[model samples]
Target: MLGGKTPSEFMKLPIEERENILRGYLVTDDDVQIEEGDDFGLFNKEIATGSLLQQEYFMGEDEAGKQLVKEARQIYYRENTFSVRSHWLCEFICDTLADGKPIPIESLVQRIIVRVDVEDIYDMDDDMVDFMPEGEKEKSWVVRDLRQLLEFTNAEFIRIEVSGRGALDGSDPQTQEKIKEISGIVKTLIEQFGEKLTIRKLTQLNDGQSIFHDLRSWLMLE
Candidate 1:
């Protein structure tokens, strides 16, 4: 409520003006709370920089603008939606025929978010699944197993993402030294799967500009 404007209203202003307001909004109050799940929370940087606004055509003001937002929302899922939060959940949604139980992802409101953030111990109970075209039932198999895990289901490009939090925490496998191991996982998935499989660590800080793009330039992804 700084300057008597709601977050939504603040977004409508030009980025030059919006950035000025946000500077005060963020620093003026110690107790100021970020609106989680709101456009403001998810895309603060992109919105403040006008990157996201430019993409959505200033928040879908026209019919043509509406299509951009529509397509963005369809293809762009926030980071936490997939491997960042639930790496294992991805195996269930594979386009390939697997023996696992079916996931009830029928409803638009329903998303299958399974959190498997346990410390990786070398115990017998450890559940290590890989997408490296291995022969483990819990792991992803190439082609005949999870067809789209590698080859494109329909889209021209693919991205598979994971978190470095585990490795950073000095877990059994993801020791602090192995912090870059997650990169290997990303590489393995893309290398083993379709050549187009590319993963980038974009945000929601959640629905930010980098979360969705029209493939204007691959260099922009980095």
Candidate 2:
């Protein structure tokens, strides 16, 4: 058997044993392009090609469908849920943008594209029918535009932080200094956002749960 023996010992064993003990190795050459300077041939080839070509095609279709679903969901949530659609929340977002804060698109998407209390929503509306749009849901043009604007605003904040007069060592700094400056900017943005944006408190008990509870009660009556 290959056992725990070294390479020499494994070699001494039978061919089958040696094969069992063999681990893969990679031999690199000096001419190999291992860095950014290396050639990166580019073409607009579709993703997931080869035998999985169908899967690739399906990916775009599925993505488009998902986007539609998200748009429908946001519209529904905005119309129905006070907890999600409070004036305070909108102001918070506006203030964050105004204060030149940089928030990631992925993070924002995750926050909006979820139903925190689907069960609660259902229980509140006994006659409610959960009907989704046929085919995959696509994102609304409005949401897409808003997201783009936020991303652009974030980029501006990043630029200001890196190149502003307040920046002690602005441009052409060493890698270490650049990293430190960026970290400081991120921290400042976080602090500004926290000061303005307050999370909506959602409790299981309906008693005295903000004005939203009253809204839900009225919705239930209607």
Candidate 3:
């Protein structure tokens, strides 16, 4: 139109003329309006090559913006699935009695520590145990030689808000009761073996509060 030519012919002009054509397209000599999200209509090859070549026109405004929106959504939900999962393990430990026989002190300690470590895999928050990932092997419990693993879990939970969050607290007091249960196991072991059930390095992170928070942090970091 700017060069006394049709829209198709005008497209044959150089890049500078292409800009002029776009300017003419935007202005309406009479009355014209275009709404967003409406089809732009089939474009001629030359016009498409020249006008649509610009990033904003051809790609639209939302290409990169949509990716960022998706990423934010992903970030928002990254830890939720795991959070729902870690609780089942806690329930299992709390609800199940160890074959009606007392859980050995070292064994009980080992189970609790391993459980705490497992919680770290799903969540980043202080309270919350993440569900295990699909087909992943759970860490072994150090029931036999409970020195290093127990201490490591104990220390890690402490650093990750053991007092604020861990298996030591719950609404039903099951976690605490479990501790006493474990202590009893230790006590019995002490009587049977004629040796002190002294855990010199690792101290349990229970403080009479819900420890889901502690477990969540541990698993999330993991």
Better model by TM-score: candidate 1 vs candidate 3 = 1
lDDT of 1 by residue, 1-222 (tens): 225653455456775675454343222222211232433435343323322422443444555444433333333221112222333334434311111324222121111222222233212222534332365433222212223243223333344332233322233343222223333344455455445554333222333433322111222222
Residue pairs in clash, model 2: 65-136, 65-137, 67-137, 67-138, 67-139, 68-137, 68-138, 68-139, 69-137, 69-138
Q: TM-score of each candidate? A: 0.26, 0.16, 0.16
Worst 10 residues of 1 by lDDT: 106-115
lDDT of 3 by residue, 1-222 (tens): 235553334445675655544544332232121122223423222222322322232222455423322222222222111111112333322311222322222222211222222222332332221344545222332112222223222121211111223233221343333333234333333344332122211224447333233222222222
Better of 1 and 2 by TM-score: 1
How far out, in Å, is residue 196 in model 3?
Answer: 33
Over the stretch 1-222, how does candidate 2's per-residue lDDT look in tens digits?
125543334345665443322211111111111122212211112110211111223222355333322332232222221112211223323322112333223222212211122111111122222242445222222222222223322221211111111112222233223233223323344355432222111223246432211111111222
Q: Give the Cα-based TM-score of candidate 2 against the true structure.
A: 0.16
Report every candidate's CA lDDT.
0.33, 0.24, 0.28
Question: What is every candidate's alpha-carbon RMSD to the true fold?
Answer: 14.4, 23.9, 23.9
